[model samples]
Target: MTSSVRGAQLARLLGQWHALPGRHRRPDYAALAAAVRGLLSDGRLPLGVRLPAERELAEALGISRTTVSAAYRALRETAHLTSRRGAGSWTTLPQGHRVATSGLWAAGDDGDVIDLGVAASPAPDELIGAARAAADDLPRYLGSAGYHPTGLVELREAVADDYTARGVATSAEQILITAGTQQALDLVLRLSVPAGAPVLVESPTYPNALAALSARRARISTHGLDAATGWDGELLLGALRQGRPRVAYVIPEFQNPTGHLMDAALRERLVATAHTAGTELIVDESFVDLSLDGAEMPPPVAVFDRHSRVVSIGGMSKAYWGGLRIGWVRASAPLVQRLAAIRVGVDMASPVLEQLVAVRLLAQAPQIVAARRAQLRGRRDALLGALRDHLPEWTVTVPAGGVMLWAELDGPISSALSRAAEDVGVRLAPGPRFGLDGTLERFLRLPFALDEETLTEAVKRIASVRYDLDRGARPTWRAPAVIA
Candidate 1:
């Protein structure tokens, strides 16, 4: 596209009455910097594409011209973008770098014990074979320069079609590939919530999501999670009804750590509540396809919404393999356009080669699911049984789908236990990380991502540790005396 036409398109995009957002009005320098980095990473803006002039962009985005000028200066300083005579400002690639080599979140050392840290199980031999086959198809991608921003078209259509097959019918136009669900969630948050706005997430949910939200300085209100009763429809429904948060974030299908499914009816109602309140619902189904025991799961929340009120996030990291690092968002065409705009500023696009691999996986879905299903089932049983056998007093909910068991210890020793477990080479996620307060101290998130032997060894290691410190010898509640 020529600069004039591109500029005109940009004008129309900005002309659409500015929803630049209330919280975004003040202009956060760090966020703007991160956004600039994201855009350059993705090729949507491309190297050497002239940025809209400061004054013009300020008017277009309906923000102060000072903010735009400051943001441009910030990007220029970082070398993410530069300005020169006779040319407007332009975005440039980060100098000689690997995109995934660095980021806010990172994996722990491989030597760590029972790294229940990652929610993904190791790839089975079958997937390896499939990936090998996928590699064989790579020569085809060579026809192009491999800079696919919206992901390979085949993968986009296939991802959309998979949901369609599940009765939630989606079209390829609604899809955009990402590095993983993490990136998908990040981008969704970037587009949906302005800095310092409220974004609702479940209590006792994944810590990384909280980290992402925190990094954005978003106001977080967590709905209650009763591990005893599984997921309470009334609690969530009440929270949504009352809080009226800007977004409702949930992992309805076998939620991480919690291993509970939001009631199906509530899924529909939740979507309705979001739309009624003008908030968006981001249903993270990263673990949806990894169900154990053949227990059926309702289609994604996106399936129940006609509009784009609910955006379903998925990735190959959890279900198929973590190394895939490819996830996607399914939304209405308009939202995709908005998300693409945000994405263009964030990372540009997911790796083109990975998208190809994902398309190949989608092609072989039937055989792959059958084999993965059996493996996950075995791991689930083993992990559950080990938890029961060792921590006999602890409660491990019967997870209908997904890896990771949300185990509540009968006693509170997680602080000492986590430290001890690390000594045993087994690094477990302390439950407190999942909640804002120390409420999850009596709980532990054990991912069944490891094989039986590893799970067994981890259980044994924990059982041997003694958390009986003199500070507080026995399990005790911290509540003050109730006035009956």
Candidate 2:
């Protein structure tokens, strides 16, 4: 079945479509087509969905119907749209214009390539033991159908206990196990965010969450973050009051890419501000357990929530291992039930064995986390030292915790540097992938999850790439053969 976006919704997504920075002005229709194409390429607009009628969209955008018609025609010529006599126009990718990987998921690590694209660590030493214990514990559930939509009772209890330990009182009934944090975010988006509604996010936030918001057809409003200061309380609160978005998704605990840990005071004020603004807050705590500096962590954001508006998501992927693929949502029991019900239609339930392994892992979390933090600290320092020695001009604020550091290049050459590094067997996730539109072109997120030698070598390779690019080395690529 095909879904359609209405006129006003499409118009909201096409905000200032005709405004192009750093390029010569084009015709209104060409500008319009380019904007839509960019959205598709950025994964903000899902393919195969019907667009609004030209007349309706023209009226919504307050443009001429002829302009909309010409834009649609241009899109069709570019193979970005398809239409039939009865069916309306739907979005598609032009042949050979398939989007580059966003590096939000796992990619094959076969070869000598040093992949700083993904921010996941290898499985810890404790994981194999945990898996063995889980296997031993799995046979008891074999007699059943093995479907636990809400999650296994023991794992739920463990997750709830963790929240309580973090100062948020929770119960087993309040937890819904997801395959990972991404799925937890997806389920919440489906349940809470309606199409055409406004959702607020940080400017350089997680790319996957932006993808999810766009997939839901929600109007994304962005708030900027500071590298030195992290969040501006007054500015963010003002945005909440002005936009009145339906939801605000924040990664307060060692936020992704930026790695700014929200202080307890800021967390309290943020929660109160969202409560006053009547926006449901989705706080991601995936990196909370990876504190490398032995600092006291702030309480979970849900602890400060007076109203039932805050939803907390955590997972073992960041702190433990990505292979386990266990994540959960902490909310009111009623909301948990609602999310579980919606989740059943998606994947039925998370695997039983993984949940069992997650339970054992949580039981060994103290020891596992201690060892992991020590290992990550050494790697992080090694990368930092390497950057300082080889690429001294780049500005990188040491992250308190998290797998990656966001470094600002001296110039807006991050994209070029990433392309050049590919030739030297170093894969990078460029800075723009973490932000809206084409912003953040001057920054790069470098992950230190690899071993010390690998991280140091990757930095050296990246420095060499930068040096060549600074000296006017241009990269060339051959066209990929299309598979017909």
Candidate 3:
């Protein structure tokens, strides 16, 4: 059965909805249909969510039931909504339109396609040994209840010690192990910020973070990052001072997509400014250990935070393996307690075996970091060379670290290119997925985490599609033969 949204809740969510910004003198029904369609297209209204009944929604919005019925009819005709006699209408994107319009993409199921959308690599050989070791230690924990909301004590201590080694004095009480960085972010946002509160985020930031903030119905304010200069301190400070957001989500070290590392001085200033503005800063440092230059990096932002306003999230996804699914949040002890309580309602606790494996993996962090650095550096160089050779018109920055490159295309056809590339055995995330609203259409994120051969072949296919798009060829939208 499909979950249903209450009329009051749906009305609250639709409070910010407005007609599309155009000069067309459309009827009220068409305008309302377009507004809801925009929400569905951008994922604000998730698929399978049953909308409020026409009469109920009309009453809530102070509109006539006839208008609401017409709007529903329009949405139904366009396949954005499906209705049953007594069950009311539910939100959904037309089958073929889901992927491209939703701004999310994945590889094909057949193993014959290259997916440049996600910047993830395979787990290292050490994972097997770690898992085996964890199994050997599992018997000891069977004597007691395994539920640990705050995470295994051994893993917490390891994470705390890891922070201490990095120049930040931390204790186990200040750390809460999470399923992954994503969960850490979700927990923090839910506990610290209320719905409709203003939240600051970097433009063209991680798409998943944006989606999380959107899910909370937060008022998002963006501070743009310069591809050449990285983060703009003044602009960020101005937004903090003016917007006075309740939270600011940022990726400080080797930021996603762009891979721009925040300098130490600016990092300190940003934290101080946020403290003065009463903004809680959530810093994601998942890629901090993947520096390709092997240079000594700046300390974590938590080191510069004196007011307990910054919460740093660290994960093994990028450094070691995404499958590890282990991450931690370093904050004040009280904040950690609050997040743990909130997490109880979410997942109850992270898996015990994964926590055990994480402990062993933490012991071998130096080796893992070094290996990932070498592997990603080689792939980065290879992808750069391929792009320069095949798609010369696209301008891209050579990121010093991180697994992806944010490249600006010669034309604003990222969405079209992504749709067409799928037909040629390649899947790409359109640029607009990384930004708020429908911005960043002229850019694309190209991940180099795959094998060199796969990267080469993917780039070849992308180049062919790019050429076709440049020649005025449009994509023919159809359901994929296979979904992965």
RMSD of each: 15.8, 5.7, 5.9
- Candidates in order have lDDT scores of 0.69, 0.84, 0.82
Task: Report the C-alpha lDDT of model 3 over 1-484, residue by residue, as the tens digit.
Answer: 7888877776664543342232135577876776566455445457899999888988888889999999899888877799989777898766655444333333343376577877888998899999999999999899878999999999999999988998999999999999999999999999987899999999889989988898899999899988767888888899999999999999988888788988889888999999999999999998888889777788889888999999999888988888889999999999999999999999999999999999998899889778888999999999999999999999998888888898998876666577667678787877767887565767888988998888988999999988775454522334545644
Q: Is candidate 2 or candidate 3 better by TM-score?
A: 3
Error of 1 at 128 (Å): 3.8
Point to the candidate with the largest lDDT.
2
Backbone clashes counted, model 3: 0
- Clashes found in each candidate (C-alpha, N, C closer than 3 A): 12, 0, 0
Error of 2 at 103 (Å): 8.0
Candidate 2: where are CA atoms >4 Å away?
1-109, 479-484
Indicate the residue-level lDDT of 256 in model 3.
80
Q: Name the lDDT value of residue 356 in candidate 2.
A: 95
Estimate the TM-score of every prediction. 0.73, 0.81, 0.83
Q: Would you list the rank order by TM-score, best first?
A: 3, 2, 1
lDDT string, candidate 2, 303-378, tens digits: 8988899998889998898888899999999999999999999999999999999999999989989988999999
What's model 2's TM-score? 0.81
Flag the better candidate by TM-score, 1 or 2.
2
